[model samples]
Target: MDHDIEKAPSAPPTRRDALRVAAGLLAVGAVPLAAHPAAAYPGDIDVCTGGYDAEYEADLAMAEALFEAEEHRAFAPERPPGRYTLPLRRGFRVSARYGIRGDWLAGHHTGIDLAVPTGTPVYAVSAGVVVLARRSGQYGKAVTVRMRDGHYAVFAHLSRIKVRQGARIRAGARIGSSGATGRATGPHLHLEIRARRGYGSDIDPVRYLARRGAPLL
Candidate 1:
């Protein structure tokens, strides 16, 4: 996912160049962009509706069971305590869920996993103050937001942190980019909605997000 973006040339395209262009577009889910000239690619086949490419889908499945390990902790679960949008845009395909699964979580899986590209933009699920923004141990580069409800939200395995601690941020604000960090086996965002601003006190973020209008499974 880490690539050096280069300026594309406007010269006459070769067959190989055309295929590369088409592939790049498809991988980004923007193949046959309306703004692109139909004849730009070889064979003049105008791709429509962003056709699915097998490689792209497989490469982008949520990172290795959403990067989890056991953490036996107790929770005084509560409702969302507020509204929220999908932590990742375009809805989700949750790779890992809340609660203990003998496979991933030890006692309780605090958050839900939304596997995505390494540099996919991550938005703040709700308005809150950035309380913690640092390289947390197994969580990698993480951000903890103190929501207006006093409950907390965690965004982990980030490639870059976009906001600073103490910053008052609103829902949908760009907070960070997803990545394969900490104990992750692949690139994805580890999202947790907690009863407070720490581990060992987590709730079902899936149900919480759903109640808030974003139903993800």
Candidate 2:
């Protein structure tokens, strides 16, 4: 008697197994010359693998180059230390801060009010040119310094102004003496940091100084 035997078929190949086969075939140059020209172009070859696509390869290379350059490049240095200093050195108290809403002020306090003596020396926060040094309306004897950083430093309510208009001064140089020359409750320094050298361009003076490494506590 003759017996018939049945055989089990092999399992389907995984994607990885197919890739390996394809890679092996490629290694031996199994790809036919009749294949697409793009696949055979040298520029289409991947930097990491045998993948094809000239645009993709170029973009990948460019991305890698950019990343490498950024990793090794030196970052921009921060502003030098001691480049800025407080307008007042010591023995002063903050009577009023910026943005205080009151009926007396035009909507809000444009700058800070440091309660100091009538003749406390006020210095330039940074190297700058004096743009205004005269009786500036409600500001009284004010000195507006066009600072090196482009922001205008307005020292308002001053009793004495030492700097003249268009005069270049160094950082920490005495600009005037603080007093209640303008609208104020008592003898104090009204400091305003303005984007322009006029009224209504006021920014927070304390915050600006703090950013330049000078803080008023």
Q: In candidate 1, how many Å is residue 105 off?
A: 8.1
- Encode model 1's per-residue lDDT on 1-217: one tens digit a residue: 1112233444544545544544553455432212211112223121111112233222211111111101111122223435576667754445555663332222445576676778889988887666567675567787877666667788888889999765767778899998866656567787878774323457888787777787666
* Candidate 1 error regions (>4 Å): 1-83, 103-106
- Tens-digit lDDT track of model 2 for 1-217: 1111233445544545544543443444332222121112133111111112232223222332332232332112123323789999878877666776543223456777787888889999987656557774456677776665557787877889998765768889999998877445568887889764334567999889888789876
The TM-score between candidate 1 and the true structure equals: 0.59
Alpha-carbon TM-score of each model against the true structure: 0.59, 0.60
User: Per-candidate RMSD vs. true structure?
Assistant: 20.5, 31.8
lDDT of 1: 0.57
Error of 1 at 179 (Å): 0.3
lDDT of each: 0.57, 0.60
Which numbered prediction scores highest in lDDT against the true structure?
2
State in Å the error of residue 91, model 2. 1.8
Question: Which parts of model 2 are misplaced by more than 4 Å?
Answer: 1-82, 104-106
